[model samples]
Structures are given as C-alpha cells and as structure tokens.
Target: MKRTLSVLIACMIGAAVSAADLGDDGLHKTPWMRDTFKDLREDLEEASGEGKRLVLFIEQRGCIYCKKMHEEVFPQPDMAAFIEENFFVVQLDLHGSTTATDFDGEENEQRALMRKWGILFTPTLVFLPEEVPEAASAIDAAVAVMPGAFSKGTTLDLFTWVDQKRYELDNGEDFQRYHARRIQERNNISQE
Candidate 1:
C-alpha cells in the first residue's frame, strides 16, 4: 500500500511538471501572452508599435489540444523566443464573459466575438497583418488562421511565414508548399 501511494504521488508530480501553469480562467498561461483590456484595436496598435504582429490565441478550459501546445510546442526555447520576438500574443477565452472590442469598433463579449470570428476550435491562432482597413473585422483582416494545435515544426513554419509576409510574395510558395519544403529539408538534415 505504501509503495502504491508513493508511485501515485510521483506520477502526479511528473504530470504537474509537464503541464503549463493555468490562469484563474483555467486557460494555460505563457510568459509571452499579454493581458489586456480585450480591446483588439488597441492591441493591434500596441503590437505594431513594438514592431510585432498581433496574434489572437483563442482557447478554452479543459482543452487537451491546447494543453498539448502549451506543453510540447510552445515551451521550447526556439519556439518561445521566436514568438516573443515576432508576435504580441493576446489570449482570448472562448467562453468568457469579458468584453472585447473588435477591430471594426464593435464591442462584444469574448464568446460573442469568437462567434463573430467563426472560431469553433479550442486552440485557434489568428494572425493579423500590420495594417487593417477601416471598418474591417479581425477575421476579415487576418493574414492567416491556424485553427488547431500543430507540431513544433509546423507552428514555427507558420509563424515564420507570416512574419516574413510570404503570403504576399508572388513566388507561389503557399503555406502548404512552404511546410512541405521545410519537412523535406528537416528530413534531409536528419539523414546527414
């Protein structure tokens, strides 16, 4: 009985260490995530002023995929540093009652805003461009939207692609192509 109890305690401690810290809202909290008044227009302005792109991270409580991202992909030094350097991240609760101002100057609850953006996933990442046209909603102005959790390589590639404005380039390397190329490069490097 004592051995079983010790084993249980050890497993609990290991799980705790592997998981990211949770906020009062029950969402995973990262050091790079900013706490704002949920005003997206102001958030965008602040991000741009800091030479970083505005990224909206939509998550909810009890999401295993969100937990996987926070634990496996986001905590890596390269991934974390890259995100910190290039993106001003804002966390939005999918079911929270907190008020959030949209880029179109419309104010609504965070959940309502998520509905407006057509978000149906726990870990949707909305990447916004630097300049938003007047009267455009956040969804309409987004350069890219990652709708679910991705592996570290894919996440890094997406972030780098958005940061480099590869979507605007006429080279015909879309995200699919870009990600495939990166995978091939990684494979080749691993075999060397």
Candidate 2:
C-alpha cells in the first residue's frame, strides 16, 4: 500500500510540473515588446493592399491560457506557417497602459481601448481591415470582434472563413457545422 501511494504521488508531481511548464512558456520566454504604432500602421496599410487582414491577439501578463496559446497553438508548425503567410498578427496586452491610436483616430491607452471596444474578457481575437466595401469606415466597430480562446482547429477555420468572406453567410448556418467543414477540408488538403 505504501509503495502504491508513493508511485501515485510521483505521478501527480510529474503532471504538476508539465502543467507549470505550459503555463510559463510563450512565443518566447521573454515577452514580446510592443511594436510602435507608426510601423504597425504602415504594415497594416501594406497588408490591406495585399488582401491580408489583421489579427489582434489580446492577452495579459501572467495569463496561463494566453501562454498556452502563444506557446502551443501559435507555435504549431502548420499553424505558424498559415498565420504568418495569411495575416498580420499583433499581440496586445489588456492591462497595459501603453497608448495606441486606433485606426478610428481614437487615442487611448490599451486598457481603455479594451473597454471602449466592449471587450469584457481576455484572449479576444479582433479581426481588422474591418472596412470591406460594405462598411463606412475602415474599422467597423461591430464587425471586428471575436472573443475568447479557440482550439487550433477553430483558429484556423476562423482565418479561412474570414479570408473567403464566408462570415457574411456564416450567420445563417450553424457555425459549428460550418467551422467543422472547413477544418475537414483543410485536413484533406494538407494530407494530400
């Protein structure tokens, strides 16, 4: 009985260590410093011309899920390749006091932008170049937001859905079904 108990305790310790590692790893052990808005704006401008969209990943320091997404999901070989090729990625900190002038010309700190943008939670993925010919402004307040954690499959599906402009009709169908079909299609292509 004592030997069995000892083995159980060892396994628990190993699991705890694995979880801790996942919680601490990110895109790099050092946090990514924010890029200047001037440079980012120029990059976004170029991306718009090329038909690539913006993907803003909102997170906070010390967030375990944020770390996991950056380390595990974003770094997945296929995921990284796809994101790098298709979208301009930006990481924003929700609690940060750094100022950013949004495309709307609203000058506010990051935290204030989070609130002004109606984001109540972390790990939100806000898509941009929100203008599309249908909207009045380049950044539409309503259409740019997608919140919360998404598994790898869902993340890729979202990018493809947005790229294809399927989001316009996604509202009419079951979102899960639509997203699943895209995932399956991607799998088949990748396998081929």
Candidate 3:
C-alpha cells in the first residue's frame, strides 16, 4: 500500500511540473510568444521591423501534441534559441472568442478564422513572408503551413528553410527534398 501511494505521489509531482509550464489559457507559455491584439497585418509589420519572420502558432487547450511539443521539442536549447532569434511568434487559441484581424482586414472570432483557414489540427504553424500582397488573407499569403506535431529535425528544417526564403529559390529542392537531404546528412554524421 505504501509503495503504491509513493508511486502515485511521484506521478502527481511530475504532472504538476509539466502543467506549471502552461499558462492560465492552457497554452504553453514561451518567452518568444507575442501578446498582440490578434491583428495579422500589424504582426507582420512588427516582425519585419524586427528583421524576423512572422509565424502564427495555432493551438488548443488539452492537446497532447501541443503538450509534447511544449515539453519535448520546443524547450530544447537549440530550438528555443533559433525561434527566439529568427521568428516572431503569435499564438492563437483554436476555440477562443478573441477577435483576430486577418491580413485582408477581415475580422472574426479566433475559432471562425481557424475554420476559414481550414485548420483541423492543433499546432498548425503558419509561416508568412515579409511582404504580403494587397487583399491577400493570412492563409493566402502564407509561405508555408506546417500542420501537427513534427520531430525536432523537421521542425528546425522548416523554420530554417522559411527564414532563408528557400521558397523563393528556383532550386528544385523543395521542402520534401530538403528534409530528405537533411535526414540523410544526419544519418551519415551519426554513422561516422
């Protein structure tokens, strides 16, 4: 009985530690996340002014994938540092009532905007270019949209590729090819 009780206590402690990282909104609280008025155009301008790429991170409460990313992937030193230095992150709740103004100047509740964007998953990362065309929505102007949780390498590669504006390059190496190359490089390094 004592052993079982001790084990239960340990599990509770671990859960508490993990939950502490989350904010009252149940979103993972990261220093890099911007507290904006949910205006995409202004966010884009602010990111460009800071010489950083604009990234919209869509998440929902009680999403295990979001928890995994917050605990395992994003907190890694390299990933954290890379995001902090290169991207301006704006987080949006998947089911929240907060008003969000899209790049095209259409305003709606957060959930409605998510529906309009056709986001069906938590942790959908929308990476935007520095310059967006007039009358283009956030979804329309996005350079890359990463859906669901990804491994460390994939996440990092995506961030790097978008930041470097690889999408603009005429190089035939698209994201799939680029990811494959990176995986191969890592395998070779590990083998060596």
> Which candidate gets the maximum TM-score versus the true structure?
1
Task: Please say which candidate is ahead in TM-score: 1 or 3.
Answer: 1
Pitting candidate 1 against candidate 3, the one with the higher lDDT is: 1
- How close is each model in CA RMSD to the real structure? 9.2, 11.8, 9.6
Q: Cα RMSD (Å) between model 3 and the true structure?
A: 9.6
User: Model 3, residue 182: displacement in angstroms?
Assistant: 0.5
Give the per-residue lDDT digits (tens) of candidate 2, residues 1-192. Answer: 633554455445532222113223232221222244623355467667755676677777767676666655665545554555567666666876777666656667777877767666667777765453332222353344667667888877776666666667636744567787777888899999
Could you arrange the candidates by lDDT from highest to lowest? Answer: 1, 3, 2
lDDT of 1 by residue, 1-192 (tens): 633554455445543334469999999998789999988899999999999999999999999999999999887666676777789999999998999999899999999999998999989999999999879999999999999999999999999899999999999899999999999999999999
**Model 1 clashing residue pairs (backbone):** none
TM-score versus the correct structure, for each prediction? 0.90, 0.67, 0.88
Q: Residue by residue across 80-168, what tens digits does model 3's lDDT show?
A: 66777789999999997989999889999999999999999998999999999879988899999999999989999999899888999
Residue 11's lDDT within candidate 2 is 49
Order of the predicted models by TM-score, top scorer first: 1, 3, 2
Worst 10 residues of 1 by lDDT: 10-19
Query: Once model 2 is optimally superposed onto the true structure by TM-score, how far is the C-alpha of residue 185 displaced, in angstroms?
Result: 5.9
